[model samples]
Target: MAVLTASFFALLLAAAPAKAPNLAGTWRGGGFEIVLKADGSGTIKDSEYSPAEPLKWKASANALTITEEDEPVAYSFKQDGDRLHLSGGDLDEPVDLVRGAASAKASSKVDPQAAPGSAAKHVGPGSCDGACRHYLKCAGQPALQAQCVLACYSEGYGADFMGWFQSLDCVAAITVIAMLEAQSRGLQGGGGGGASQSKECEGCRWDGSSCAWYSQGNWGSNVAYSGAVITCNSSCCGR
Candidate 1:
């Protein structure tokens, strides 16, 4: 009987699933950017309107727990190729995040004229336009000006929203414009845009009842909605 019991336990162990993959990289969604580290510690940067927060994380076989705001929130995640799909807790539907390269390294010893591939590039204040000049003046130094612009842009601020950026967030706008300018000159940052690059869904808007999601830059499908929140369907957004 003891031999039979041991055999049964071994079978159960063999049937168990393997642990989840290590999430030790940068992930970007529509409104959030998470940098999960190997040490279970990381930082989250919300939209330009919200301040960044540091948090600790723990991962199990199929779920991840984030300790933020003195509370633990659990999220079940699945990995599909280069995308990480997360769902649960406050999320009505799964949110897909594309894996990005590691965050920019510290700038203390970084060379100013290294290369365009370098995360931080020192630009003279005179190179900025009128809109960017206002923010650069307050930034004090040219290095700080560039850092400020990159910081805001990295937080996912680019196009001018209705009330998202009036004048205070001009730094973010300038950074995005500069990147576009560079791309036009065949000097795109982070190499040329590839399939991994995130593209904004064109023509995504609310009709009268449901949120309309577009595929191929035009209206394609509508997702039902009753609450104030509108969730994008994975079929449409999970590219």
Candidate 2:
């Protein structure tokens, strides 16, 4: 339960720009899919994230902003024809994406006014609501509580949580404790907490239902101790 210092938040606020480029399209790369709409609303799907995570986005001339719930994370971006490149945020390295056919309901037209997007939709610090709810679900399973809580916080706080704490020694301590707790609880398949007992293979990313491993370099999965699987990357833990 490490707290993010005020300076960290200040850094994020400073990274934001007054405007953004139109990124209305479907972009896919690695194990993630991002759909940016014309109206400033968007959805990001990643094997490591909750399915179809709702988001708001905007960009300056060279930066992209992604707002989840109500918190905004910024990344430098460049659009070249059908390819989109992104750096910063939670990425250990830059990610490249290719534009694909969007869903029928997805719009690509850019409305300059709509670029303001969903920021006004939320009042204050609402992302915690989603994170807290997920933490509660994980709490039901005694063996997996810590791992689950970690995941909840990671998603809820986004870069704020991941960018800071995951790089600390406490993260490893948390993972080790979670593993020991699981053994002490005698984790079995389909336990009383309704927790899944599936183990993530090394170098694979768990997509909630399955583990996906990519051959490309610079890819790794988060520590999944015992049956409580919270998959991310070693970079996220500052390995």
Candidate 3:
């Protein structure tokens, strides 16, 4: 009867449901963040500066579903150690998130940029001036300006929303800078012209030749750029 009992227990174990993966923690990537609680409640934010939105999530071994705005969205997910990769269901592209450290705490009252060890800090008074000057210096070179913006953002150069906006003015200053540079060089290329408007480039005007910036309604907003055309309400530069 011992053999019989052992086989019966094995069968029962086989019939039991598999335990869900442990996803209760904060995950962040590319300025987007999600905090999943053990109690199935959560919050998601598109950026470090944006407000969080409430959410409810349930997970199986290989799938995760999030309910927000009274609607349910599903995704196929895979976790490799502390890295989470999610795809499908309202996602145009896959999003990868890294698990926060053990001491990381996220809350409605917290400013994400102010988190411990966060790389978001100011450069004293008039922090925007440095970035604007950098843009002016690199006006003729798109590659240099792009690299400058990327480096500035990564180095935590801006103090607040206005400071961040001022840094973007670096891109705007390209017009005047390019114009003066061309005149000095006796080059035929001129600055300032109407670029083709699109949904992506809203709140920004791009000169046909080079340079683009937030002309209106781009405050405290993320932007996306495709070549010269800028996409509003999305990431500025993926680099």
Task: Say which candidate scores most in TM-score.
Answer: 3
Question: How many clashes in candidate 2?
Answer: 4
TM-score of 3: 0.46
Q: Model 3: per-residue lDDT, tens digit, 70-167?
A: 78999999998778889887564576677877224323223433332122222224343444433433343323555555655664643653244333
**What is the per-residue lDDT of model 2 for residues 1-239, given as tens digits with 9 covering 90 to 100?**
13567778778889876554658888766435688998999898543222466789987788888997587999998888777889888555576666776322222332211111101111123333333333332233234545555655554456443332222222232443354344334344434243333232234465555544332221122222222233433432233
The models' CA-based lDDT, in order, is 0.48, 0.49, 0.53
Measured against the true structure, the TM-scores of the candidates, in listed sequence, are 0.38, 0.41, 0.46
Model 1 TM-score relative to the real fold: 0.38
Clashes of each: 0, 4, 4
- Tens-place lDDT per residue, model 1, 1-239, is 99999999999999988866778887766345677889999877533333446789988877988887576889998877557788885443566666664223322222322211111112222222322333443333333556655654554533432122223232343443443443334323345344213222223355545544322211112322121122232323333
Higher TM-score: candidate 2 or 3? 3
List the candidate 2 regions with Cα displacement exceeding 4 Å. 1-20, 48-50, 101-147, 150-182, 187-239
Which candidate number would show the highest lDDT if scored against the true structure? Answer: 3
Alpha carbon deviation, residue 92, candidate 1 (Å): 4.1
How well does candidate 3 match the true structure, expressed as C-alpha RMSD? 16.2
